[model samples]
Target chain A: MKTIAALCLWEERIAPRYDRSQKVLVVHLDHGKAVEASTIAVEHLDREELCKTLIAMKINTLICGGVVDPCRRTLEQAGVKIIDNVIGSPQAVLSRHLAGALSSGTVVD
Target chain B: MKRLQTPIPPELILDHLAVGVFTVDPDFLITSFNAQAEELTGFTRKEALGRRCYEIFRADMCFEGHCALRRAMDSKSSIVRERANILDKRNQERPVEISAAVLRDKTGAIIGGVETIQDDSNRAALEKQVKASYSFGDVIGKSPAMQTLFEALPVLSATDSTMLILGETGTGKGLTARAAHNASPRREGPFVKVNCAALPAPLLESELFGYRKGAFTDARSDKPGMFELAHGGTIFLDEIGEMDIGLQAKLLQVLEDKEFYPLGGVRPVKADARVIASTNRDLASMVREKRFRDDLYYRLQVAQLELPPLRERREDIPLLAARFLQEQGALEGHTARGLSSAALKLLMEYGFPGNVRELRNILEYAAALKPGGRIEPADMPRYLLRIDCPPAGAQRAAAAETAPQSDSTPDPTPERSETERKAVTDALHQAKGSRSETARLLGISRTTLWRKMKQLGLGW
Candidate 1:
């Protein structure tokens, strides 16, 4: 089955605060090849709603910068894998994640 | 007689004052420390000098983004009498009132900052005495109803039984749920909360129990729901009465079997989450009306807690009002001291239909409308003015009717403002018309004393 990942994007790099991120980038992969991508505008929703949005999108993985305990726990409990505290451009993180080089709590500035 | 002509040092002058005074450079490094500052902070001048002010005084706001000296320097203005707490050398918390101003060198260039600190233990104790014991996490209430709730929280938080909370809108249903999660053994786990009424049935269903990649166009990959995410923790369902009838059956299945199937998944996911549900509507009535399922309602009611509305707990009004005022003042950089007696009376008399949330909004409005100093009755929102509180004229008429027969004698019960004005005038007279001296005696800021004198039409 193909995997989908969502990255909390600020401008070019990941957002500093996961709960207050306004933009989310969802990427779809088939056999490790990029198939489709979408940008979701999530400024209207709060932290809880943001989690629900990721779940609804069937996003199995989430990549972002700093995430607080409550938000990280909620995402983890939902069975979605999170690689947080990553500090890099969305493209770099996505590439790293695809290569399986990205690990949770690694700061890839 | 030959008089000894010796000039008193500047440090000696500052040391003789009752209040603690200190100076800090633009970088927040301690520059000069008076004797009183040394005594209050338990740090000598030798130890305090050349060190960061926070390293010595260790005020709560020093590293909390509310440093008075930093604010003064940034704004190039004076912060008149803001209350803060500091930790001394022994790590004892000492409440203090801080006033700071930007210091300028020759040629009008900003140099450093000067701050004065006064011990506020007596004042803080009195204010705490007024509020009594009304604190639990973020929940604030002093009424018997809230007390009962507080007493039951510890025991309820220890168990994972399905618990139902009944309360009106804005009555702190969510706060209580969070408090339970924070106090529970599973506090390390996630607390997932969903407002059942916030989303439509389709979206809510997907949100609660996720779907497979091909279940829908948006579902590009398998996803998990709030229940799965709340494993070993808690899931708060707010406005549970608004949940869809069909969804309620599915929820009951999860509660019974401790497992639930995703929308398109063939396998059932284990549900390790504890359920905490809340509703504003009467579930019994909803069950009778066929809007709510009887079985689901019974399952949720295994442990029930009914939160009392703010109107029912009137005794907590003053405390809540004061707390809100202080919070607003701190956030907005205003000096909101307190409320006028008339304003407090108005707040007490008005029945808050929207409960504590409404009270918070009301105070926010009053804080903006108030020109300066304490909030007055006139500062309240116009909507609150429409509420049928007893008018001042009615009180005067009632007083007149109840008074014993007298030949045009003066009324004995004076208004609070009048008494305050008389006290200010007397203090000013005793201080020989020095506003600063009067403020020190009255335990207020010189700015406040000046404002009072001007408002009261005192010639001085």
Candidate 2:
């Protein structure tokens, strides 16, 4: 059983793009967790609210297209594991995360 | 040759010079007049000969009835360079400079005076031209804020990097963005603008990334979005805070990839557009609330520029007002006379809540009321004239009473405010009460959030 978050591109279902402020979806999984997932919108939330909401939701990982420097530092300080630059459907990206096959490169584009 | 040397007549000597000349006896009667003087007055020398100089010129004598002739008589010396205005037979006023000398007999006894009057009409016309040329462009001030902005503009213009402009609504953010775009390498490229707050999410999405033919029910034909149209150009997103969460994420992707898929389109299109976003709202706060995407915020904020509000740069009001006046005057075809010293003082003392925009509006309104007239304090708006000068004691008492309540009342915070409070709490909770991390998630400087928490007495 593993829970992973995937921040996907809205227009392209094939590949997901990272959010500018590094926001992603928390995908709950345990072989069969009904594919239930929730997105974290960090566009308006400051660092404090963003961290608090994620922790309250008990998200294990954050997958976003892009992460701002301040939020990246704050998330790293909170001991959150970041798997960035993952684009696609939540289900497809979650499979890669579970199989330990996600790229760790920072997506700035 | 030595036989007949007739003494040159004084009248003949005076009549030939181009300058007007006239003389009055001690009796104040016109005694001598030259041809130029006759031409200037529209009267022949024969008609003006016996009339009083004041009667011929239609001019009141000096304050003490002391004309140039009277001065020569009193001092028994020549009175040179005396200036006055004279009225001709037709009552046309003329400015004249006069020179007079006392006529003395062999015994050195004082007599009537000989006065020379020269027209100064050309000099007056030249003075008028000089005054007209001194206008708004002459407004000068050396404030640190202005100096800093001027120095920063060149550097900001050199790059095509995304700029995040932060300032109050009327603080000339749009102007600054235009200046930066105009100065940049993209000067020749199209400069597109989108007001994030003015349009709804669906329209904004379509506007930014054009939809394909039959993309939606109303889709008629292929249209280029701002991203495509502004390719090789700059796009300004104003009030970026109002954009929806989904759009924010999409925008973030576009920034990251420099590519986007039009709505309902199969292919991804590459966009080579520079982004410049501006907002009065606190994006960092929105980020913390999970309303704004954190990643997008960072991408858009590569180079941040913050403008001071009008209140912060009050010294620029006079310069801004003068510029506005000249612009309005030129458009309206009137002389742009500047404000009186008192009016300038009043403007400096008032706080401009609407910033530079409001100042322009005020000047335009004033100009409409009194075109080409000197702007006195009375000409200012009624509200500005009645500004409350609060007593120091009252202000201190008010601050003391109001300051504690905001921190004391932690109960029943309204929905939006409470949501903001909750958002802060959530960020703090996830960060394990780490203020610095919380500030980052909140998208605000640590100092600002620190002050907010301290004011609310929300002990972490």
Candidate 3:
């Protein structure tokens, strides 16, 4: 059962693009319930390094803003499912994701 | 009533301009967004302000930190006519031309960054412009890696920080060094190249920091070192990893103090030369092993650019080959014009261990073997035919696609896949999911193991 998800970030707000994000908020989900979350500095990492870090963290679903095709494909190839083009604050974004209402292109004010 | 013409605010003048304009604070949050910016990015000024500019326009460069505004701010220079693609509010691709610079306050302190965008949706103009800047100095590359490096060179050249260039053998380290020097503000200064591996410690020391008269038996007259000769210019240290640890300390002093002591002189002479070092060696490992100085390594790499080898960016092979062949043709009385497509395909399939230098040598050999015009596969060195490539149709399809390619396209034969699967699975089981051990047991490189795992859907 897949559970771990990562939300790419810019400060407290979800960055509009995955590649440009400086941080990622990693969350652990149990039976669709949010449980634990933490942030990892991701600004210094290149696309491949960023993918490797997430994969090492066992993240299966990545919730973020627009992802350039190359970055999305790289993550997908590594078995991390990407839900891109999302925008909102962490609380709002995580809430929608917990409700199973989060998807690509979701703009939560 | 006399008509009073209230002077139009300059802010309104900016809004009416055709070019898209925007400003970002130090944190990269949008401080202002103009009307033209709204039309180009599909994000209104209200929606953009206070939000990060990256979210509004998901540009390819932004994701990789190759941002134009970021570059301008870092290198304290302006970026003009750089090309980038972004996704609009509607998620539609918007091709844009960027010109950017750091924004300064009243006291000339950098407060933020400002950028102007020009619509570059005209494919014809984009292609034509791309061709003109395909090569920087003598280094030519159209691949993404080269393009990124090309953008970085100007940014790096503008600063005075010590630069360390990393690359494999024959990967144009020298050309890149020369290119950096040419583009740098110190272009008029003498560019000196010193190979650290070339001399013994004593000779190299004296050569670098010249000896005074009567300092040694051989020193009959006062002589200036490479450091002195390179004053007001750039000094390139090639193969810096091979620099002796003892000499490295002195070099570090020069880097830190901006001066070096002559072999026999009492006073420290000011060394005004800028330093750019290059090496094909792994300095990090050398530092770990204590063969290289850790402090020097840190200081030298304050700003570094790495040149990718030929095998990793195979898309550049054809372009590089054409340039080399054309130059070789001119050199050999027009004996070689170009390579046939079949010849190019064979060259692409081969992993060029020697990088660009090897390609040049091979072309020179072929040019000598063939009298004139397009060189065919038969005219090439026999050693280049070691690898068997996919069918021509598959290669064509790959060339036609502009998107990122899969791990390995034109799928491996079923027999090969079955063998790889069994070997990898067995190795993984034995290694207990340790990729390094699996690769070792299977006698394949680590990167190869990772690619096979992805291709076979055998993620651990």
DockQ of each: 0.02, 0.00, 0.22
Candidate 2 DockQ vs. native: 0.00
- What are the runs in model 1 whose C-alpha is more than 4 Å off? A1-109, B1-133, B389-460
Chain B only: TM-score of model 1: 0.60
- For residues B1-460, write the lDDT of model 2, one tens digit per residue: 5775788898798888987788777786778889998877656787678665644554334422566777788888888887676655443557777788887778877657777778888887787665433321232223567566666666877887889988765567788788788878998999899888667899999999999999998899987899999988899998887788899989988988889999989999898988999987667867887767899888988888877766666777877788889999978878877999998887787555445665676676578778999888877654456544232333223222221122333443344344345556765775578898665544343554675576556874
Give the TM-score of each candidate. 0.50, 0.46, 0.47
Candidate 2: segments with Cα more than 4 A from true spot? A1-109, B1-142, B387-460
* Number of the top-ranking candidate, with TM-score as the measure: 1
State each model's CA lDDT, in order. Answer: 0.78, 0.67, 0.79
- State in Å the error of residue B167, model 2: 0.7
lDDT of 2: 0.67
DockQ of the two-chain complex in candidate 3:
0.22
Q: What CAPRI grade goes to candidate 2?
A: incorrect
**Better-scoring candidate (DockQ), 1 or 2:** 1
In candidate 1, what are the lDDT values of residues B1-460, reduced to their tens digit?
A: 8776997899999999999999999888789999989888877898778776765666767635798999999999999999998766543668999999999988889889999999999999999865544665567888899988887887898998998999766678889899888888889999999989778998899899989889877789998899989999999999898899999999999999999999888889999999999987778977987888999999999989998877678898998888888888877777767899998988888655456776787787678777357888888765456434343443233222221222333433445346446556765665677877565544343544565565456765
Please give the distance, in angstroms, between residue B408's alpha carbon in candidate 1 and its true position after superposition: 60
Ranking of all candidate structures by their lDDT, best first: 3, 1, 2
Q: For candidate 3, lDDT tens digit of each residue in B176-278?
A: 8888888889999999999887788889998898988888788889999999999988999988887889999999999999987888888888999989999
- Residue B426, candidate 2: Cα error in Å is 43
